[model samples]
Target: MFPNLELVKMVADIENPTLFSHDLKSADILFLDLIVSGGNINTLADFIADIPILIITSAISRWQYPEFIKNREHFALQKPISLQMFQSCIEKAIQP
Candidate 1:
Protein backbone atom coordinates (compact mmCIF):
# COMPACT_ATOMS: atom_id res chain seq x y z
CA MET A 1 0.00 0.00 0.00
CA PHE A 2 2.01 2.98 1.29
CA PRO A 3 5.56 2.07 0.50
CA ASN A 4 6.69 5.58 1.23
CA LEU A 5 4.94 5.93 4.53
CA GLU A 6 6.49 5.03 7.87
CA LEU A 7 4.54 3.30 10.63
CA VAL A 8 4.88 3.51 14.40
CA LYS A 9 3.13 1.50 17.10
CA MET A 10 2.19 2.71 20.55
CA VAL A 11 0.29 0.72 23.13
CA ALA A 12 -1.95 2.34 25.75
CA ASP A 13 -4.23 0.90 28.38
CA ILE A 14 -7.69 1.87 27.20
CA GLU A 15 -9.07 1.22 30.67
CA ASN A 16 -7.07 4.26 31.72
CA PRO A 17 -7.26 6.55 28.75
CA THR A 18 -5.36 9.34 30.44
CA LEU A 19 -2.31 7.21 31.05
CA PHE A 20 -0.84 7.87 27.63
CA SER A 21 -1.97 11.43 27.10
CA HIS A 22 1.48 12.88 26.50
CA ASP A 23 2.56 10.18 24.07
CA LEU A 24 -0.31 10.71 21.61
CA LYS A 25 0.72 14.26 20.79
CA SER A 26 3.55 13.03 18.59
CA ALA A 27 1.41 10.61 16.66
CA ASP A 28 0.43 11.57 13.12
CA ILE A 29 -2.26 8.92 12.89
CA LEU A 30 -4.23 6.99 15.45
CA PHE A 31 -5.57 3.43 15.14
CA LEU A 32 -8.18 3.31 17.87
CA ASP A 33 -9.98 0.19 19.07
CA LEU A 34 -13.33 1.32 20.44
CA ILE A 35 -14.24 -2.06 21.93
CA VAL A 36 -11.44 -1.83 24.47
CA SER A 37 -12.14 1.73 25.48
CA GLY A 38 -15.79 2.67 25.76
CA GLY A 39 -14.67 6.03 27.16
CA ASN A 40 -15.90 9.34 25.79
CA ILE A 41 -15.02 9.15 22.11
CA ASN A 42 -15.83 12.80 21.62
CA THR A 43 -13.28 13.84 24.18
CA LEU A 44 -10.67 11.70 22.49
CA ALA A 45 -11.62 13.18 19.16
CA ASP A 46 -11.19 16.68 20.54
CA PHE A 47 -7.87 15.75 22.13
CA ILE A 48 -6.51 14.71 18.79
CA ALA A 49 -8.14 17.35 16.69
CA ASP A 50 -6.77 17.80 13.13
CA ILE A 51 -5.06 14.41 13.14
CA PRO A 52 -6.30 11.47 11.11
CA ILE A 53 -7.93 8.66 13.06
CA LEU A 54 -8.71 5.16 11.82
CA ILE A 55 -11.24 3.50 14.09
CA ILE A 56 -11.17 -0.30 14.21
CA THR A 57 -14.09 -2.14 15.71
CA SER A 58 -16.68 -4.85 15.20
CA ALA A 59 -19.59 -2.54 15.98
CA ILE A 60 -19.02 -0.17 13.11
CA SER A 61 -22.73 0.37 12.45
CA ARG A 62 -23.35 1.47 16.04
CA TRP A 63 -20.89 4.36 16.03
CA GLN A 64 -22.66 7.73 15.96
CA TYR A 65 -19.90 10.29 16.18
CA PRO A 66 -21.28 13.15 14.12
CA GLU A 67 -18.05 15.12 14.25
CA PHE A 68 -16.04 12.15 13.12
CA ILE A 69 -18.51 11.31 10.36
CA LYS A 70 -18.49 14.87 9.11
CA ASN A 71 -14.72 15.15 9.16
CA ARG A 72 -12.75 13.59 6.33
CA GLU A 73 -9.84 12.87 8.66
CA HIS A 74 -11.78 10.19 10.53
CA PHE A 75 -12.34 6.69 9.17
CA ALA A 76 -14.03 3.55 10.48
CA LEU A 77 -13.08 0.01 9.60
CA GLN A 78 -15.05 -3.02 10.71
CA LYS A 79 -13.34 -5.91 12.43
CA PRO A 80 -11.67 -8.63 10.36
CA ILE A 81 -10.69 -5.76 8.07
CA SER A 82 -8.75 -6.71 5.00
CA LEU A 83 -5.40 -5.16 4.15
CA GLN A 84 -6.93 -3.61 1.08
CA MET A 85 -9.65 -1.96 3.12
CA PHE A 86 -7.19 -0.73 5.72
CA GLN A 87 -4.99 0.64 2.98
CA SER A 88 -7.94 2.34 1.38
CA CYS A 89 -8.98 3.99 4.67
CA ILE A 90 -5.46 5.21 5.34
CA GLU A 91 -5.22 6.62 1.87
CA LYS A 92 -8.51 8.43 2.24
CA ALA A 93 -7.63 9.90 5.60
CA ILE A 94 -4.26 11.23 4.47
CA GLN A 95 -5.43 12.63 1.19
CA PRO A 96 -5.26 16.40 0.78
Candidate 2:
Protein backbone atom coordinates (compact mmCIF):
# COMPACT_ATOMS: atom_id res chain seq x y z
CA MET A 1 0.00 0.00 0.00
CA PHE A 2 1.02 3.59 -0.58
CA PRO A 3 1.43 4.61 3.03
CA ASN A 4 2.65 8.08 2.13
CA LEU A 5 0.17 8.61 -0.65
CA GLU A 6 -1.79 11.82 -0.20
CA LEU A 7 -4.79 11.99 -2.46
CA VAL A 8 -5.27 15.54 -3.72
CA LYS A 9 -8.88 15.34 -4.84
CA MET A 10 -11.40 13.27 -6.74
CA VAL A 11 -13.72 14.56 -9.43
CA ALA A 12 -16.76 12.50 -10.34
CA ASP A 13 -17.17 14.64 -13.41
CA ILE A 14 -14.56 17.01 -14.79
CA GLU A 15 -17.12 19.25 -16.46
CA ASN A 16 -15.43 22.28 -14.97
CA PRO A 17 -11.73 21.49 -14.93
CA THR A 18 -10.92 24.82 -13.35
CA LEU A 19 -12.26 23.54 -10.06
CA PHE A 20 -9.45 20.97 -9.92
CA SER A 21 -7.03 22.67 -12.26
CA HIS A 22 -5.01 24.12 -9.41
CA ASP A 23 -4.60 20.76 -7.74
CA LEU A 24 -3.41 19.12 -10.95
CA LYS A 25 -0.67 21.65 -11.42
CA SER A 26 0.95 20.75 -8.11
CA ALA A 27 0.22 17.07 -8.13
CA ASP A 28 3.14 14.64 -8.15
CA ILE A 29 1.19 11.97 -9.96
CA LEU A 30 -2.00 12.13 -11.96
CA PHE A 31 -4.61 9.37 -12.11
CA LEU A 32 -6.45 10.34 -15.26
CA ASP A 33 -9.67 8.73 -16.33
CA LEU A 34 -10.52 9.37 -19.95
CA ILE A 35 -14.22 9.07 -19.26
CA VAL A 36 -14.12 11.66 -16.48
CA SER A 37 -11.32 13.74 -17.91
CA GLY A 38 -13.72 15.60 -20.23
CA GLY A 39 -12.08 13.92 -23.25
CA ASN A 40 -9.37 16.53 -23.26
CA ILE A 41 -6.41 14.87 -21.64
CA ASN A 42 -4.14 16.69 -24.03
CA THR A 43 -5.41 20.07 -22.94
CA LEU A 44 -5.28 19.08 -19.30
CA ALA A 45 -1.75 17.81 -19.65
CA ASP A 46 -0.75 21.01 -21.35
CA PHE A 47 -2.32 23.13 -18.63
CA ILE A 48 -0.36 21.41 -15.91
CA ALA A 49 3.34 21.64 -15.25
CA ASP A 50 5.79 18.84 -15.93
CA ILE A 51 4.08 16.03 -14.06
CA PRO A 52 6.45 13.13 -13.35
CA ILE A 53 3.96 10.44 -14.19
CA LEU A 54 0.44 9.95 -15.51
CA ILE A 55 -1.66 6.85 -14.99
CA ILE A 56 -4.33 6.81 -17.65
CA THR A 57 -7.41 4.69 -17.00
CA SER A 58 -9.59 4.18 -20.02
CA ALA A 59 -11.48 1.65 -22.06
CA ILE A 60 -10.21 3.10 -25.30
CA SER A 61 -7.11 1.78 -26.96
CA ARG A 62 -3.86 3.63 -26.49
CA TRP A 63 -3.36 4.00 -30.22
CA GLN A 64 -6.67 5.80 -30.55
CA TYR A 65 -5.47 8.63 -28.34
CA PRO A 66 -2.45 10.90 -28.57
CA GLU A 67 -1.89 11.07 -24.82
CA PHE A 68 0.74 8.38 -25.00
CA ILE A 69 2.62 10.33 -27.61
CA LYS A 70 2.16 13.65 -25.87
CA ASN A 71 3.20 12.37 -22.46
CA ARG A 72 6.05 9.94 -22.75
CA GLU A 73 5.95 9.16 -19.05
CA HIS A 74 2.49 7.63 -18.99
CA PHE A 75 0.83 4.28 -18.47
CA ALA A 76 -2.40 3.25 -20.15
CA LEU A 77 -4.57 1.00 -18.02
CA GLN A 78 -7.71 -0.64 -19.26
CA LYS A 79 -11.04 -0.08 -17.57
CA PRO A 80 -11.22 -3.37 -15.65
CA ILE A 81 -7.77 -3.25 -14.15
CA SER A 82 -6.56 -5.79 -11.65
CA LEU A 83 -4.82 -4.90 -8.41
CA GLN A 84 -1.53 -6.31 -9.66
CA MET A 85 -1.66 -4.41 -12.94
CA PHE A 86 -2.41 -1.19 -11.11
CA GLN A 87 0.48 -1.78 -8.75
CA SER A 88 2.85 -2.49 -11.62
CA CYS A 89 1.81 0.70 -13.37
CA ILE A 90 2.35 2.77 -10.26
CA GLU A 91 5.75 1.24 -9.77
CA LYS A 92 6.69 1.85 -13.37
CA ALA A 93 5.48 5.41 -13.26
CA ILE A 94 7.57 6.16 -10.21
CA GLN A 95 10.65 4.55 -11.62
CA PRO A 96 13.54 6.71 -12.69
Candidate 3:
Protein backbone atom coordinates (compact mmCIF):
# COMPACT_ATOMS: atom_id res chain seq x y z
CA MET A 1 0.00 0.00 0.00
CA PHE A 2 1.08 3.58 -0.65
CA PRO A 3 1.40 4.57 2.98
CA ASN A 4 2.83 8.07 2.75
CA LEU A 5 4.39 10.70 0.53
CA GLU A 6 7.67 8.84 0.58
CA LEU A 7 5.95 5.62 -0.38
CA VAL A 8 4.19 7.40 -3.21
CA LYS A 9 7.42 8.99 -4.32
CA MET A 10 8.94 5.56 -4.60
CA VAL A 11 6.31 4.47 -7.13
CA ALA A 12 5.00 7.46 -9.05
CA ASP A 13 5.35 11.17 -9.61
CA ILE A 14 3.78 12.85 -6.60
CA GLU A 15 2.18 15.45 -8.88
CA ASN A 16 1.43 13.47 -12.01
CA PRO A 17 0.16 9.95 -11.59
CA THR A 18 -0.37 9.58 -15.32
CA LEU A 19 3.13 10.44 -16.40
CA PHE A 20 4.90 8.07 -14.04
CA SER A 21 4.25 4.92 -12.05
CA HIS A 22 6.81 4.69 -9.24
CA ASP A 23 9.52 2.09 -9.74
CA LEU A 24 7.65 -1.10 -10.51
CA LYS A 25 10.71 -3.31 -10.46
CA SER A 26 10.67 -2.94 -6.68
CA ALA A 27 7.02 -2.11 -6.10
CA ASP A 28 4.55 -4.49 -4.49
CA ILE A 29 1.20 -2.83 -5.12
CA LEU A 30 -0.01 -0.49 -7.85
CA PHE A 31 -3.14 1.63 -8.22
CA LEU A 32 -3.94 3.37 -11.48
CA ASP A 33 -6.85 4.42 -13.62
CA LEU A 34 -7.45 3.07 -17.08
CA ILE A 35 -9.49 5.98 -18.32
CA VAL A 36 -8.33 6.26 -21.91
CA SER A 37 -8.49 3.57 -24.50
CA GLY A 38 -5.28 2.46 -26.25
CA GLY A 39 -3.38 5.65 -25.47
CA ASN A 40 -1.97 4.72 -22.07
CA ILE A 41 -2.16 0.96 -21.76
CA ASN A 42 1.30 0.35 -23.17
CA THR A 43 3.06 2.87 -20.99
CA LEU A 44 1.14 1.84 -17.91
CA ALA A 45 2.03 -1.77 -18.43
CA ASP A 46 5.72 -0.95 -18.79
CA PHE A 47 5.73 0.18 -15.18
CA ILE A 48 3.98 -2.91 -13.82
CA ALA A 49 5.92 -5.63 -12.11
CA ASP A 50 4.66 -8.85 -10.56
CA ILE A 51 2.28 -7.00 -8.30
CA PRO A 52 -1.39 -6.65 -7.61
CA ILE A 53 -2.77 -3.99 -9.92
CA LEU A 54 -5.80 -2.19 -8.59
CA ILE A 55 -7.37 -0.30 -11.44
CA ILE A 56 -10.09 2.28 -10.98
CA THR A 57 -12.57 2.43 -13.78
CA SER A 58 -16.18 1.94 -14.65
CA ALA A 59 -17.56 -0.47 -17.18
CA ILE A 60 -17.73 2.39 -19.65
CA SER A 61 -13.98 2.73 -19.93
CA ARG A 62 -12.79 1.44 -23.30
CA TRP A 63 -9.21 0.58 -22.47
CA GLN A 64 -8.22 -2.85 -23.67
CA TYR A 65 -5.71 -5.10 -22.00
CA PRO A 66 -2.42 -4.31 -23.61
CA GLU A 67 0.17 -7.06 -23.65
CA PHE A 68 2.23 -5.44 -20.94
CA ILE A 69 -0.67 -5.20 -18.51
CA LYS A 70 -2.30 -8.39 -19.74
CA ASN A 71 -0.20 -10.62 -17.57
CA ARG A 72 -1.31 -8.92 -14.40
CA GLU A 73 -4.58 -10.17 -13.00
CA HIS A 74 -5.82 -6.89 -11.62
CA PHE A 75 -8.80 -5.89 -9.56
CA ALA A 76 -11.10 -3.49 -11.38
CA LEU A 77 -13.52 -1.18 -9.67
CA GLN A 78 -16.64 0.22 -11.20
CA LYS A 79 -17.37 3.91 -10.99
CA PRO A 80 -19.19 5.37 -7.96
CA ILE A 81 -17.63 3.06 -5.45
CA SER A 82 -19.05 3.35 -1.97
CA LEU A 83 -16.81 4.34 0.92
CA GLN A 84 -17.21 0.94 2.49
CA MET A 85 -16.28 -0.82 -0.70
CA PHE A 86 -13.25 1.38 -1.14
CA GLN A 87 -12.03 0.61 2.33
CA SER A 88 -12.68 -3.07 1.94
CA CYS A 89 -10.72 -3.16 -1.27
CA ILE A 90 -7.76 -1.56 0.39
CA GLU A 91 -7.98 -3.78 3.42
CA LYS A 92 -8.07 -6.88 1.30
CA ALA A 93 -5.19 -5.69 -0.79
CA ILE A 94 -3.06 -5.10 2.23
CA GLN A 95 -3.93 -8.35 3.92
CA PRO A 96 -1.87 -11.38 3.12
Number of clashing pairs per prediction, in order: 0, 0, 2
Clashing pairs in 3: 11-22, 12-22
lDDT of 1 by residue, 20-82 (tens): 666566667777755444455555655566454555444556445445544654567877888
Task: State the lDDT of candidate 3 residue by residue for 6-86, as single tens digits.
Answer: 354333223343555435555665655555543544455545655554554455443564545545566656667877776
lDDT of 3 at 72: 57
* Model 1 ranges off by over 4 Å: 37-46, 50-58, 62-73
Q: Give me the overall lDDT of model 2.
A: 0.72
Candidate 2's displacement at residue 1, Å, is 1.9
The residue-by-residue lDDT of candidate 2 on 1-96, one tens digit each, is: 877568988877665678878888888888777665455555565555467667778887877766444547577789899989888887787767
Minimum summed lDDT over a 10-residue window in model 1 is located at: 57-66
Candidate 3: stretches off by over 4 Å: 1-22, 36-39, 57-70
Better of 2 and 3 by TM-score: 2
TM-score: which candidate is best? 2
> In lDDT terms, which candidate is top?
2
Q: lDDT per prediction?
A: 0.62, 0.72, 0.53
Cα lDDT of model 3 overall?
Answer: 0.53
State every prediction's TM-score relative to the real structure. 0.62, 0.78, 0.55
